[model samples]
Target chain A: MRKGIPNDPGRRDRLRAVALEFIAERGLRRFTVRGVAERAGVSPGSITYYFTDTDELIMSAFELLTEHAEPNFNVRLRAAGTRDEAIEVLIDYVIDPDDASQQEVRAVRELYSLGSRDPKAAALVRDRLEANARTALMLHFTEPCAHALDALIEGLWTQRSWNDEPLDPGMVRTAIHGLVTAFDSLEGTSA
Target chain B: MRKGIPNDPGRRDRLRAVALEFIAERGLRRFTVRGVAERAGVSPGSITYYFTDTDELIMSAFELLTEHAEPNFNVRLRAAGTRDEAIEVLIDYVIDPDDASQQEVRAVRELYSLGSRDPKAAALVRDRLEANARTALMLHFTEPCAHALDALIEGLWTQRSWNDEPLDPGMVRTAIHGLVTAFDSLEGTSA
Candidate 1:
């Protein structure tokens, strides 16, 4: 077997990173393969060589953002001493104004807009979101509570997207506490 | 005061309805003031005479759609046999495929995408959403529970926008049930 090109993986990752930044800055409506290539100091053909089209580049960039965030989020959740701490970590990550990943929030919103018309994009987003929800649920709660918790977390994220005011951390914590208690009581009954 | 212009109000309503249909079919990306005027069977100058710009047209169409849906929703909710019945009515309205007003759902999602970059659109969506939330809370639950329920309902609508599989009516009922029960429990504790 021929050895893989030594720097090929690095180049591919660099291209995706640049594309993500472009998506964040200009939005998917304005994102172009040539733009990404130019910003990455690469040829336009290289983008085409790596990604089938702009849609693929965008979908890949979205997948990469989630993949990057997942491990860190899981670690934070696992390390939290209390449910309140876990909820706080989630809210802080979600609503932080300084984070570059916040741009992904807007990007995902744009993707959803496109997805309404494009079935392929819709499928890509739906599949990834369901997978993310399932993974998050499995990580955080038992089977009985996982579905409801997923719904609650998803609701929180959606609210953050639309609400102009910064979320009150205390209110979020109170909701989380209520959810946890509700789930615990639910578990006792089902058991 | 000048006597009301006969047919003037009817002409404006017809123009707004046509604008809604055109925008829904072609999307805001391809929408043009001239195109809307042509479809509405009015002169381009007439369109401009009524609305200053494309943004004004879009904002007006959105307002028209919201106003049309609001009263019907309120009437249905008020007529429900019980609180549970009201929740069911709300859920059915939100997820109903047969409802023509569902186009409003699509329009709202588009407005959200626009809101990310356009402060005016963002403010419009936020103000309307918050006002609706406040009104619903005042009618359905105590202040705190209303706030929480508003977030939940808004989150559910956003999720519905991207979901590929048709929402199960039963699942929707479960979510509403959980939220209502949680609020009722909270209210009891406070009492």
Candidate 2:
């Protein structure tokens, strides 16, 4: 079992915040305990004391981001009156992303890649993506429809990060709406 | 500007092959020139001597993978004269992945993450995805339709990596056909 830090929430939060910063600025490739320590204004030993395992620390930091993101999203999703409303809610989230800084988007992408190599991290990523997939599956679309929607959501985010111009929100909505309409007509319950 | 490695293709290929192995086995997180030297059975100096920059080496290895993958993919893609046939070709590549080893999938994902933080690497990744998206766009679909299709293709691949079962080719085909059919109906030249 891993030991806890000095029982200071502030201190613990600081360490996590610093870790996220490292992940954001340098990416997973350069994220290091010493880097977190130096940025946190604490000793490297302090970070190790709080989190015995690096993966645990990484996961903890990620959960913090998720914890911050999911509530409002879930609330909005629940409040959505219709299937179309629910998808619009989802689209808004994707277009804006969870972190206003857009830090999580990059960090999450890094984690997703990290998951490929790190079984534990991969599991965490899978859990989040699967949760999203489940939500989509529950919609009127079939399994493949859900999968395609999920992929389009992720793919657009990725495309935005690379494209010279920032993605036009109207175009994104049009594209997303087109996908939903198309899928609805194909496998929708009413049709 | 990066200096060229030695004029020997064999040495350069060995370095890249070793780098690919490290990327495949450990991923880019632990990928280091020193590590490459140890795995390649060469001194650290030799690694530095051949590749002036680490990023250059990484990019070279990536380009090598691309060169190996794209030609075969393009040939198959060209052979598919019909729009439906082209999507099938796309599906096969994503489903089976380029390398049966599945190493390329993970490696490419890592490069994608790397791209978000590293401008040069991001450019390389963008170029490849853009090229792919362009090919899709040139088909029967409009720009947004093509983007959605491109996104869905990538999204399905990602979802599969996390899903417990192997991606069903039948399910994939069904989902793809649905999306295409939906789009075709929406923007049919006749309609």
Candidate 3:
């Protein structure tokens, strides 16, 4: 195992980390093995050996990004003692990510646009969405509610990323609270 | 006015129209002045003559694309006689964009990602969002609902673009209805 190159866990992680950093600093149009290798203190040959090509490298970095995000979500969910608290957690997760994580949103979006054109990357993003929906399902959401909330979350970030309007404070919480309470009443009637 | 080269109205419109077509077929990375000019049967200098550079051309293409979408939204809004019909219109607008417009979605997304990096492009998108929100306000939605719906629309597209799970037929309608009904009840209580 040549450290930070091949057959080493640390090398793989480092490569992924640096790849994301480069994407964050620059857009995906310029993501290059040589650029990452130069920044990461690894040889370009090593990055190729491990990643094969730019698509592989982009996918792997994205995988690392999603993996990094899963724990925060788990923590947010665990912190919710009630359904409303859980809704708050979900909204914040979508719109109010920490500074470092905020950067990831832009990076991931670039990857997503890439995915729309590239099936391999699309598969990676799609797998994550499925797993996330399943996780929401496990948390007692009805199927439609699960999909709606997921899409709503996606929409909030999508708006924030490209929109000019400053999202009002408490807006999401109001919308989400309204959504869950409606469903709660529906559950009441059905039950 | 040198027909296809500057000081001419037709030249600008033609350039914007062709730029969008190329973005849909090839995405933004390969969207170039040369390519667009070649496709339009004009010299590259003509493109530069009409638009200052690539960023200006891209931002202009985005402007033309959004302008094209606004009328459909207005028509959809006008067609809906009831709140439910309006909600349905909103859902369809987000998810079931038609063939030419489907390309616009991809094209807009690329422009959006481009906005995050380029201030000039970002300014263009932001201006459109402000105008859109203003129009929604004139339609009489409360502030929260308007932003939430916008975000939901954005989220639906985001999920469709990246999520692995296929969206259910009525999933968006259900979610939008749920949120709207919740707020309606809230309004009922307050009134």
Candidate 4:
């Protein structure tokens, strides 16, 4: 079992933060206790003291990544009064270059890469995505539509990252409007 | 410039195949000349002879991954007679477990992880995605809709992968239907 510190939650948090930075800057395969320790200005023993297993540390870092993202999404989403506004908010979140920093993008890619091979990690990613869909449901989207919207949002975010040139905002908005219109049409249907 | 093995194209192809398998099984971060050497049953020096730089070897492996995926997609896509059928083909490509082997999924995830850091790699991934969109255009989808559909297909495929439980085929089909119907509505629009 991994041991937990009775105090110094801040230190544990710092270690996890540094670990995520390590993952963001370097690939996950290169992660090591010593690497994180050096960055955190702590000894290797100090890191092991909080989390006995490296997997546990890595997972903790992933959780931190999620925790950082959710609140920001929630704040903007909760502020929207109507479904259309919410949809626009989601689009803005995806297409706005400032919304997800490069560090966050890198961390997400690393975690998703880990998820590709590890079911437990996959579940963590799924939970976040499903949570986004669930929020969409609250905004009047049907279940399937909500899920599709969630997928579209993530896909757009990823696609934007890959393009060397900037995405034309007008085209992106139009494309998403088309999708959301489709989902709206299905609102009264069985789907 | 990287040296070309003009005399033994077969040997060069074998090296790329082995490198891709190594990437699929392990990961890019863990890829090393010695590691690929043992797996390929060749000496590390011989591996370097083919790929003077490790980055060159990794990129070639990625190209091989794309080559394997594109033909399967192209054949099915070309066979679709209408836009609706093309969409179905795409959805099947995503939902069908048999379509993409687990190895392919792992390798793609690893490459996308690399793309998160490397602009050149990002371009490669973007090229494959844009190619899919272009095929959608040939099937009569509008430019914006084609790009949107491409993003949706990729998003759904990724979403399905994250789910540990089997996705209900009916729900998956319905979700895609809703999105496509919207794209179709915009068929003649300037978008």
What are the TM-scores, per candidate, against the unseen true structure? 0.76, 0.85, 0.85, 0.87
TM-score of chain A of each: 0.75, 0.78, 0.82, 0.88
Q: Score the docking of each candidate (DockQ).
A: 0.32, 0.55, 0.57, 0.53
Candidate 1: list runs displaced more than 4 Å: A1-15, A30-57, A63-66, A69-75, A78-98, A142-144, A162-164, B1-15, B33-50, B69-72, B80-85, B91-102, B164-171, B184-191
lDDT of 2 by residue, B2-29 (tens): 2554377688798998887687678788
Ranking by TM-score: 4, 3, 2, 1
**How many Å off is the CA of A59 in candidate 3?**
2.1
lDDT of 2 by residue, A1-191 (tens): 24632377788887887787688678878888888888888898888878887777787777665555445456676677788787788678667754453676677777777788777777777776457545644554556556666677777777777776766665566656666665566565546
DockQ (C-alpha) of model 2? Answer: 0.55
Cα lDDT, model 3, residue A17: 93
| Ranking of candidates on lDDT, top first | 4, 3, 2, 1
Error of 2 at B27 (Å): 1.6
Model 3, which residues run further than 4 Å from truth?
A1-6, A78-82, A162-166, A185-191, B1-6, B78-84, B162-166, B186-191
Which residues of candidate 2, in runs, are more than 4 Å off?
A1-6, A69-74, A96-101, A136-144, A168-175, A178-191, B1-6, B70-72, B97-101, B136-140, B189-191
Clashing pairs in 1: none
What are the RMSDs of all candidates, in order? Answer: 5.0, 3.6, 3.4, 3.2
Which has the better DockQ: candidate 1, or candidate 4? 4
Error of 4 at A82 (Å): 1.9
Task: Name the candidate that leads on DockQ.
Answer: 3
